[model samples]
Structure formats: structure tokens, C-alpha cells
Target: MKWSEVCIHTTNEAIEPISNILHESGASGLVIEDPLDLVKQHDNKFGEIYELDSSEYPEEGVYIKAYLPMNSFLSETVEQIKLTINSLKLYDIDIGNNHVSLSEIDEEEWATAWKKYYKPVKISKRITITPTWEDYSPVSSDEIIIELDPGMAFGTGTHPTTVLSVQALEQYLNKDDLVIDVGSGSGVLSIASVLLGAQEVHAYDLDDVAVESTRVNANLNKLGNQIIAKQNNLLDQVNLKANIIVSNILAEIIVQFVGDAWDNLEQNGLFITSGIILNKKQLVKDKLEQQGFKIIQVNEMEEWISIVAKKVL
Candidate 1:
């Protein structure tokens, strides 16, 4: 089989949304090459270890590469991805140089390319996310392991936004509590929720691909029974109440569903929001407040921010 690698030269701020576009367009796997990873200091708190080759990263803006099967619809999918990424500008997202290019490669080459970019990374105090191919063992008795196949979704569970969400969950989630994961891309959060002690989780995503990816990842961690993956737009019409509702999506989309999230959460229920750029942090905070949520915690990782708000009347 052949694969076409679609590479988008975009800004760091546009990473989350463009990655979503690629995932929704049926990309098999993704590789993000950010120059910051080369220079940023990594905290090996949980014995996290990984190496990045400077040559793989771009000199300036970030590079997001997605692999799509070379099929009849490949061209159409890439074009549609471009259009959707361009649409992000309307949300006031700085897309930067949105130059897109494509290349053909053998299945073997494509597989090897993306696998190198993912490795075992301890994203939170209690959780370590590693690719399925990596042989990793927990460093501590309390450490949790989340095995993810990025080929099935958009993230490896090590992205800053995901890290923030997982850390927040670790701090606030109680044993036997119910969790609702909005925009459950790759289902990492839902899986993490269960591993961290949630009784059950409802994983929702608008894209069926994401829904299926969530299911696959849930099963990957032997959590098929604990997580219910479904296709739904944000929290629309979701009547199931949860002790915690977690969403790691763009700030704009997060604000749109603030009311729905409030409606679907129990009193004092926690609403954890991530995938927010620094500039839009206050926007989300204000919306959550307007909906009568009390801000409990505000956490920042690199250029992204996560807010933990409580539904208090």
C-alpha cells in the first residue's frame, strides 16, 4: 500500500485546530515537528525520556504532517483539509504560513516516520502516555500508563493541552466519579479518567472517526466497558450528568458549550477546559463565569492554558 504525506507549515498556535482537521479528514497518523521542542527544558519528574533531532524541526513555524492512504479520494480530502484550516482564521486564530505540500511514500516508510516522533512521556504526576509500540513499565507504584496508537487519532496524549487536562483530572477527579469527555480525540482523556479512578466515562466527539478512535483506544487500555464512546456535537442534548466534564478543544468551541456543560454537570461538578491559547484564556474564563461557574484553578503549560471551574449556584 502507498501513503501520501500531507505536510502543513503552520504556526504553533494553529496546531490543535489543524490537527483536528487532519484527523477528521481520515489521516491515519500525525507527526508534529515543533522547533520549540529542541530548545525547551523538559522536566523528567517521572523519569520521562525522549530525544528530538534538530534537523527534523522547521527553522521557524511548526510543521504538522499527516499520513493518508493513497486512494481515489486522497486529493479531495487534502483540499478539504486546507479549506477547513483556512476557516480557523474566522475564529481569530493566527494560522501563520499555511503552506501545504504533499508527497508519496511507501507504507513501510510512512510507518517508520511517525513512530520515531512518539515515545514514552510522563505528562502528569500520576500518568505516563506511551505509544503502543514502546516497551514501557511504570516507574512508580502509583504511576498510571496510557497506551495509545496515534495512527488511530490526532494526538499521542503528550500534547500540552492534554497534559494540562490530565494533570487537572489527577488533582480533582474522585474515585468512582463519572466523567464526560467532550471532543474526546483519541479518547486519551477518557482512558486516563478510568485509569485514574473514574467509575465510568462518556466520550463524545462530533467526528465519527474520532468516536471510533476513542473506542479503539478505550479497548486498547482494556477499558471498553468503562468508557462509552459516542458521536455528538460538543455537549448538545447530552442529558447524562457527570461529576466532571473535561474538554481539550479550542477556546472558541469550549465557550460555545459552556451552558450545555453546566446543564449536564452535577452541582459542584468540575468543568476542565484545555486547548486554549494564552490570549483567549480570559475569553473562556469569562464565559464559564457568565454561565455561573466558579473558577477553581487556572493552569498553563507552555503556550496553552487549562481552566478548572466548578458549577456552583
Candidate 2:
């Protein structure tokens, strides 16, 4: 299979409006990236709600989108989006009359060519990861280990939510605990939870890539049996009552799951959540509290925060 990419120039201020316009223009999917994220440094906006890597990206000039020929409207959609950019006076991502370009490449080239920025990341002292093709060893003396393939799956443990979820799992889990990981991205949290002591783990996510990624990660850890990865949305599809529930997803979605996450837990079961920006912390806290879950702990890192709460009567 071959893929085509459409590149446009615009400021950060115009990204969303442009994205929406492009979506309305009939694009199937979007690959949003910040030009500043190519650097290790970052800048915080909206209390980290608007995060930018803030140093420099290799091709610092354009924001690119890729889709099949069936979806080239993204280019025309973005072209129209630029007219609004002129009205808004945003300077961060100015393309200045640049034309969108298209390129064709083999499927394998996407991983090797487009993914140089993503590197393997470890969570806590327990997990160590090497790509499936890369040879690695797990120390028998250490606590947790996770192996992964290089892909777009959520849990390389690099995101704040994943790290926080791993830590939260460590704090509350016991060898006898039954854990459910909702929105289990790369099976990172599920794999880590089991390694941390959860007796059994049932992991679920809505995305097929995530389900397969989690499964591959499980195989990498040689724990194909410990982390049961399933392609589902929430716990409603599953039959078991969970002693712990971990969700590392966006704040908006967390609000929707507040009631359901509560329903799936065992009495006094733990609910761990991250993927919230700092400003939205209280918002999520209030919503979860309204569902009768008492906040147990909060971990904050780089304007990103995670919360662990327990179900109460």
C-alpha cells in the first residue's frame, strides 16, 4: 500500500480551526504534529493544555497530513483554513501562500522514515523496553519489564498519564487485586499493573491498533496470559468486578466515564486517571467526587497530573 501526505504552513493558533475545516472538508484521519516538538524542551500554554515542545522541529515550517487519494480534500480544506488564519492575525504557523505537496511512499517507510522522533521510554524502575526487532534483556532482580514494537500505541510510558498510572498501580495494587485497565493504549499500564502485583488484568481499548499493540507488548514481556487485552470501550462489556481501574485518557472522556468507572469497581476499589492538563485537575476531581469516589492521591509532573481515587458508599 502507498500513502500520500499534504503539507501546509500555519501558526499554532490556526491549527484547530484548520483541523476542523479539514475534517469538515472530508478527511478520514489527521496526523497533527507541532513543529517545536522535535526538540527535547517544551513550553506550557493554558496550564499545559496547549503543550508545545518549543525548541524546533526539523521541518519547522509546515504541518503535514497524510491520507489516501480518497481524502485529499484535507489539502483544499487547509487551503481554505488559511484564509481564516489571515483574519485571525496568528503568526506562530504562517504558511504565507505556500501550496500543499503530496508524496507517495511504501507502508514500511512510514515507520522508519517518519518515526525518528519517538524513542523507547521506561516507566519507574520496574519497566524496560526495547523494540521487538531490537535485542534486549530483562534483569531478573528487577521488578517489572515491558517490551514493545515501535509504533503509535499509547504506552511506551513516555506520557505523563502512563507514568502516573504505573506509579498509582504500584501504590494500591496487591498480589490478590484484580485490575481492569480501560483505554489500554499499548498495554503498557496493563502489563505494568500485573507485574506490580495485580493478580489478574483485563485490559480494554476502543482502538484496534491499541488492542493489537497491547497484545504485541504482552508477547514482548512473555506474559501473553497475564494481560488479557480486548478491543472494547469500557468495563460494561466485561463480566468481572474490578478491584482497580486505571484510565489514562483525555480529561473530556474521563468526565464521561466517571459514573461507569465507579460502577465497575469492587467496593472501595481504586480508580486511577491521568491525561488531564493541570488546569482541569479540579474539574475532573469534582466530577469523580460527584460519583462518590473519594480522592486518595494526586501526582503532578510537568503540568500534567494523575489522580487515584477509591469508591465509597
Q: All candidates' lDDT scores? A: 0.89, 0.65
Model 2 pairs in collision: 10-93, 11-92, 11-93
Candidate No. with top TM-score: 1
- The most accurate candidate by lDDT is 1
- The residue-level lDDT of candidate 2 at 198 comes to 76
lDDT of 1: 0.89
Clashing pairs in 1: none
| Alpha-carbon RMSD of each model | 1.6, 7.1
Report how far off residue 293 is in candidate 2 (Å): 1.3
Model 2 CA RMSD to the hidden true structure, in angstroms: 7.1
In candidate 2, what are the lDDT values of residues 1-313, reduced to their tens digit? 5656555555443443444344434442345455544443433211121234444232554464544342545456556654654554342333444445566656566546534434444556566544455455665577455666645534346555666777778778888789888888678788888777777888897766668778888887777887888888666656678999898876666888788888788899999998776777998999998889999898886567899999989
lDDT of 1 by residue, 1-313 (tens): 9999999999999998898888778787788889888777766443233688898888999999888998999888888998999999998999999999999999988878778888898888888898899999898999899999878656777778988898999999999999999999899999999999999999999989889889988899999999999999998888988999999999999999999999999999999999999999999999999999999899887889999999998
